[model samples]
Target: MISSPDDLLRLAPDAKSLEAGRRLFYSRRWRLVGGDGQWLWGEWVYGSGQRATESAVHLTAGHFVCNCRARERPCAHGLALVLMLKNDQERISVGQPPSWVRSVQYQADRQAKPKPLKDAEAADERQGERLALMGAGVEELELRLLDFARRGIADTLAQGPEPFLAAATHLADAKLPGPAGLLRRLARLGRDGTEADIARTLGDLYLFVRAWKNRRTLPPDRHAELLQFAGVNIRKEELLARPGLEDHWLVLGTAEGQEDRLRFRRTWLRGEKSRRFALVLDYAFGEMPFERSWPLAASFQGKAYYYPGSYPQRALLPSTTPGGRPYDGLVGYPSFVELRANYQKALAVNPWLYAYPVYLSAVTPTLASGQAGLADANGEVLPLHPEYDNFFSLLAISGGGTLAVFAEFDGYRLLPLSVVTEFGLVKG
Candidate 1:
């Protein structure tokens, strides 16, 4: 009663997933694959030690529920189940839906509840209580991460995003909001992100937990970075007391977005004399304006104090004076080769680094089938940010000729922010 194999293949996220589903249909590790008049259900087997997972699809609503680590919708298991119903109904055991199928059917309701914590102990602890709690929280997180790996990828799919999200309360108690945010991100991915997305986050959490356990061995600055990311806040006076860098800072670009009722803004700047990059982050409640204002492509004489870190970048400008553009030309990496090398060096010092601002020279804009990117002289292409919607405007500025671009690089993709061509500055 469901769609044909051709129609079912369309449900797969990509060709690889469709191929995988077809292979599962033929190789056949499926157990108890069955269908009731309104629903299709089956059991999928992983290798020897891994447990078999149950998957189901509602015929009328066309809903797919699966317990595999695969990130795609109607994953191999779901698609193969449909194929089984369509091709080999005799092999399927038709009957009333079992208890397991009925219980996990409404996946949204199957959240893993958070365990309780002893608030009295937390209240009594003193001196290094914060660190102690964080250490304990990190340990608990390590257990969950291990469980995720030991149980295999299908574990979360079988349970739902709740198991991953369950760590939030414990992390909040430990004052490790950053790690908690990462867990939330992982849970979201467990629900919707691809295998690659989930894997990257798992690796990040593992490294972060190990880093916390061995925090003492890290450099003093690196340790501060860890604390900074772990939701640690320092007094403004203390930060200003540290030596600040004074330079002619040029605003490269700024990006702003909103989530829920909170709006956020990030402005990036580069110093002409020091060639140093600085990021200023600000958050405002609904309809509120940001604290700092640095318009794009503007230059000013200012002193910026940076937060303590191995690769110090986020900075606060306490004061500024209107200034003209520098007499010297804008400096940038000659090619992607040097740019990547320097970026890797920065990442080596700060693995938790998010966006590394960069200036590149001698590149051309490229657009193919709705995708946009920049190409260097040697034909090396760095993709523009996936969310970028200013391709045509950027192309107009370049005029099919080479130009200099300022952007943010996040290890994998580049978010082109502004371009300086013969016509002047064009913010993307």
Candidate 2:
């Protein structure tokens, strides 16, 4: 059986699945749940008497199978069954496997066994073809962007989104889906967007295109960034090969969103010892949950392997020490000037970085001239984004006094993520 909630969370594919499993466990709808030495069996009922669907999970051989229609392997029902067993061992009595459970165990054993590769050479050939297509797509995108520039920004906007949309579709077909999706988003920038906003968007695209074209001349780290932007993925094994830093990492905040059928989760962590910030990303498809989620406002001792880059922000937690505890005090810049200076250093390393983590010490939340902002001890104020509606909550927590705040800055405005309160860490 799994050790704890953290172990079970590690098994999940994304945050959504972990949350779903938690809900299922708390609902108290499971029955006939028992565990043998190797296998666990359970019946879960969803909805009312008539509309209810009975789902079963057969957990064995370090694997699980569920009868629920969810495409996610193991599914929420299976996770909940594990959680139930962990919470109350007496709830699941050991017994001989039932016929259905045995059948599933046999199938699971067979599926777990590795099969010989059918055509390794053919797989390599296919990969080569895909790379070639991507190269052609990049060239085409450069030409399209140049043409748009020559036609003038006003004329291109007047022509509507058809051209950009069509180009995005073509890029997707060529297997450059990341850039393609970005172009589609850019096409939606209508008259509502300010002229400066439009120019910045265009400038970013132009920079990316030029950087990709001259990638060979760029540094290794910058080249890696270009490759990532073009949809190339770096394997975990490759990242783990580098040296890892062992530190007590404080889990600060998280943001989750869905694009197409994939859920993207970004968790921010700050190393207590190293004073380095890291961004941990998790992606899941369909109803699958993320591998693991760091408990917010808690600190864990772990080894984090940083990806190769001049300003290494993305990292992978290959191994972690078991228990985590609440952090005592907030650590960061004492003033807005120091914060801006640090931001400039990070920006110099990677100009394309959109959002940067900022932690301000002893800043009073204020609303002056109908604008929300934070003023440091020195009276230096940094304006908060207008869309950040949680300032009232932050104000209440601060009680009109100076407070420590963690936020994301997009060069212009700050979006608060969490504030250190007298009671505890409060998320914005």
Candidate 3:
């Protein structure tokens, strides 16, 4: 099955493409022309009169081929086709594949076949060139930061967003997308942001630049993190070579977000025996479905491969143990104090980490001091993030009583992800 609409939105190449696809869906421009058991076909008509171009989309074997001239893979026409199938499956009817659809499927199948490997020496040479380009980008970024400091942050802000945007674009062109993305976010800091927020953003950027420069001096684990933040791709082969840990991992909660063309699904897990936390990330591109999604509030015995880092959170599940049983109970910090201590410990290893899993054994939701928050047994309260929208639902579930809840702490506030209720786990 294809991903949900929210997932599709996240996988969209960019805001413009997503908006265009949404418009197509709303406008009913896509007609489900035909389908077989293995393939679905759609015809899309854009514009009116002579300006209209009839485009066709062929979906098969988790891939889409479209006759649109658009450079984007699974272009707007294809996305519209997917949306139509998802929303109006009854409109589609089974039929034989057209000649053009068969041709497209053949081409896709041929492309899917494995190709001969490239020479190791040539691959190494290409890698070296990439590293050199990234190094040059880092140096340019350092110079830009120096200039910003010399000119004063206030003055730089007064000049508007062009300078920062231009510098970020330069970094992106040089293949430093991680830093480029950070810079782009920094550039968009609005007037509503506090002075502390601006200062913290600048500090984080400065630290990242310094870490990239002095990476060699750091420990191996820290160095791995630095490389990751600098847009360096870690090969899956390398990660798989590391040792694996087998345990009963409880799925605490899940969250999803988008970064440009990529969609990220983060599943938080806790090892019942090891009492360790791990984050499993699944990514998709342009409406592609995630590899898999973990069942919430269930335990699965699996061998997890940990990425090399001081505080290893990201993991890969290569395989799962057969006949695994669900975990009967949840385990976590009993109070906000213990949760805060764990959060601080994680940050000591990875300063850039903004979110961590936290579980409160018993906390009652309350509206106090003009904010929604939870109060532990000791009467100490921790505020919830302002963006949390399930307060009333949580209140109703708990009946204003204390309940166990899994949440994400973003340095300042907690955002509830799920709560353990008599009925089962309710996700926020």
Per TM-score, the best of the predicted structures is 2
Ranking by TM-score: 2, 3, 1
lDDT of 3 at 222: 93
Ordered list by lDDT, greatest first: 1, 2, 3
Whole-model alpha-carbon lDDT for candidate 1: 0.79
Best by lDDT: 1
How well is each residue in 293-361 modelled by candidate 1, as lDDT tens digits?
677767889898999998999998878886675535577887889989999999999998878998887
Model 1 alpha-carbon drift over 4 Å, by segment: 1-127, 154-161, 187-192, 325-329, 368-370
- Give the TM-score of each candidate: 0.66, 0.74, 0.71
Model 3, residue pairs in steric clash? none
Model 3 — which ten-residue stretch has the worst lDDT? Answer: 49-58
Clashing residue pairs in candidate 2, if any? 12-290, 13-289, 13-290, 14-289, 14-290
Q: After superposition, how far is residue 61 of candidate 1 from its true place, in Å?
A: 64
* lDDT (C-alpha, whole model) for all candidates: 0.79, 0.76, 0.75
How many angstroms is residue 159 displaced in model 3 relative to the true structure, after the best TM-score fit? 4.4
Q: Which ten residues in a row have the lowest lDDT in candidate 1?
A: 106-115
Better of 1 and 3 by lDDT: 1
Per-residue CA lDDT of model 3 for 173-253, tens digit only, reads: 988887887777667773444456556776777888888778779999998877777777776777889898888888889
